[model samples]
Target chain A: MFFLSPFELKGDIDSVFERDPAARSILEVLLCYPGLHALILHRFAHRLYLARIPLIPRLISHGTRFITGIEIHPGAKIGKKFFIDHGMGSVIGETTEIGDNVTMYQGVTLGGTGKHSGKRHPTLGDNVVVGANATILGPVHIGAGSRIGAGSVVVRDVPHDSTIVGVPGRVVRHKGEKTYDVSLEHGKLFDPIESLNAKLEQKMAHLENRVAELEKEKRRSA
Target chain B: MFFLSPFELKGDIDSVFERDPAARSILEVLLCYPGLHALILHRFAHRLYLARIPLIPRLISHGTRFITGIEIHPGAKIGKKFFIDHGMGSVIGETTEIGDNVTMYQGVTLGGTGKHSGKRHPTLGDNVVVGANATILGPVHIGAGSRIGAGSVVVRDVPHDSTIVGVPGRVVRHKGEKTYDVSLEHGKLFDPIESLNAKLEQKMAHLENRVAELEKEKRRSA
Candidate 1:
């Protein structure tokens, strides 16, 4: 039976208070939070996996997934003070490497692109916050202090202190602020599609105005 | 004490066979499929909810969600043979209404806009297939035989026999193919962003050629 170090337990609890404003008490965090439960269970399963215990580790992982709705593969290496808030439908693949002080919201997938074998999942650096329903696929590196916006599908590497958003996510902000606070304002992020559509509309209006001017010139000549 | 009707059970089982070609035996489906487990549990919880049993229905729904990773609010009304393949992260909101023969994949959210109180969730018509991670938000109506593509976020009503895709979903195909089959070819779907980029590139090429022709004519005049 694998047990959590007292330091790890304290760090996990402290991280919850630091991240979630709604976390009222330690008892509530311990009992009510599925994310916390999942992480604790993962620690146990990971220990079993490291010990070369075959089927039992996977079974434990499966049971944890069923209970928590957060599927973290037993083989995934997670660092200290890792927090997942409202972590339903979050899938961490076997090869995923998560660094210290990493926070992930619900429906975040650290997955493979199904192209290559071995080390296919994402490697997240320290203090990375991934937003809701954001998919970081393939063996991409998410550098430290980066924030990935909600509903973004990131398939490429993100540099340090960057903000990523949109499908095939682009870095909207890079290396601006050192102090990283998790931003839930995903709606405020730049939408490339909407921007393109607005540009097209402007072009159409310009063309129409030019056509009207040409018509007026033709009539004046006549 | 709410139990499924015999017809409902048979229909649910039949749908598994129809949709999943790999489904060989009834026993395997009954025991192994988490999707089926969720649906069966929802039937019970939904009945309790309709009966106005306070707290019990919600508790039942919570338990089912915990086990299946598919959260269906007890207040939601789902029709017969509603199949959810790889049902993890699939959320059905409280006021959502789904018609018969609706199939949904994993990570699909039939959710609300959170701006309204009553009837705030989507209403999906018969023979509607929602693909993986597709979010149909608000009190929108999805017409019969319509297909929502993978990762599409649809906020408005969809017409019958239409195929919707993209971030703020646009109908790419409409009024064609009466027979609706669940299309997993999400990669083949028309990407609006890519199309816009291609158009821009073509315009630039055309302008470059026109500029070269103008320069040639000017040189001749000189």
Candidate 2:
């Protein structure tokens, strides 16, 4: 059974202030941030779950999901300084495990591939940042100080100090120095589709050039 | 000012019942579905927006967004028999126009490309079904009876009765018969990424065979 200490709770609130520049006051954060509300509710539900209370924990989780649109299963284990920005449609699966100082954007899903049973969800290491609409599936592990780009779908393990991007996410950058900055700019990520399209266009141009050369040779022969 | 008739309201409720097999009673739908609640609130906000009531409409929309997590700008126009399933994180931008009998799933964003001014958002024709987490961006038009697959990022216009999939969505099937089935089965849709991967694998196999044949010819010549 895991418990969040009073120091951890204060750290959570303080982390929001440190991370979000728009956070003006503690009162506003307490009242306005649905992500904070959802996390606070999740703590109670997790406590109930640790006590081996089944239905009540689930009920509390359901209520929290309804209010926040961020569904965190009571069985998911999260560490300190966990922040979810604009957490609508974010789902943390039952078997998910997270380390300290993790930041997540909206529409992120830590889910299973629908084939596994126990411990199906992914485990995140410390100082990880996940971008908007990213889906990390299966029981893979994401190592410390990694950045997952927006709209990425990761199914495999990611190494430490890596930047992951694209569908069936690929590590574009690895073994870099860990920047403790957790602020994620979603629009500035790498686009795999656009890159693929550019490659295809270049291939088409090469083929066209070859065809034109062949035509000129045929004319000379004639 | 746009007004929702009693008949339209009944149609909206009836559409939910017809689409969702889990919907047992009217009471259950009224109380349970956050999508319906958001839509109901949007109607009032839209009316107030049309009447030029300053700040009140925006306040109503803000409250609705907080409660439901479905953000519909008051200036957007929507027609009858609209149904949204698991509507959390669904965002309808201002100046967006949606036609009748439109069905949408969770996390769907009808947004702009951030380059346009007026009518920046997409316009949906009648009987369009948008799958979960599908993003339709820019001022593109989705024609009547089109089906957008789950997790697709659509930036272009779609033809009538077309089935769209992939990033920067492509129409895989077109000129199809309109079934008018609002119940969208997300798992069963065609995956363009898988298809592309399969094609690449086949090409690789062919290249390998050609290389082997060339080597055999060289050995014979030697």
TM-score (all chains, Cα) for each model: 0.65, 0.60
Residue-pair clashes per candidate, as listed?
0, 0
TM-score of chain A of 2: 0.83
Worst 10-residue lDDT window, candidate 1 chain A: A179-188
As for candidate 2, its clashing pairs are: none
lDDT for each residue of candidate 2 in A1-222, tens digit (9 for 90 to 100): 355567867888987886664455676577656678788888878888988986988998899888878899999998888998667889999999999989886789999877657889999999888866789998999998888875678999999878886677888777767445422433234445556756865775665566556556655754
Chain A TM-scores of all predicted models:
0.85, 0.83
What is the lDDT, from 0 to 100, of the residue A82 in candidate 1? 93
**Over 4 Å off in model 1, which ranges?**
A1-33, A39-66, A71-86, A91-105, A109-131, A136-150, A154-164, A171-190, A197-222, B112-120, B138-140, B155-157, B167-169, B182-187, B205-213
CA-lDDT, candidates in order: 0.80, 0.78
The sequence of per-residue lDDT tens digits that candidate 1 reaches over residues B14-34 is 889888777889999998788
**Fraction of the true interface contacts (Cα pairs closer than 8 Å across chains) found in each model:** 0.15, 0.08
Q: Model 1, A56-175: lDDT tens per residue?
A: 989988998878888999999999999997678899999999999998877999998786668999999998988667899999999988888766899999998888867778888787
Shift of residue A53 alpha carbon in model 2, Å: 11
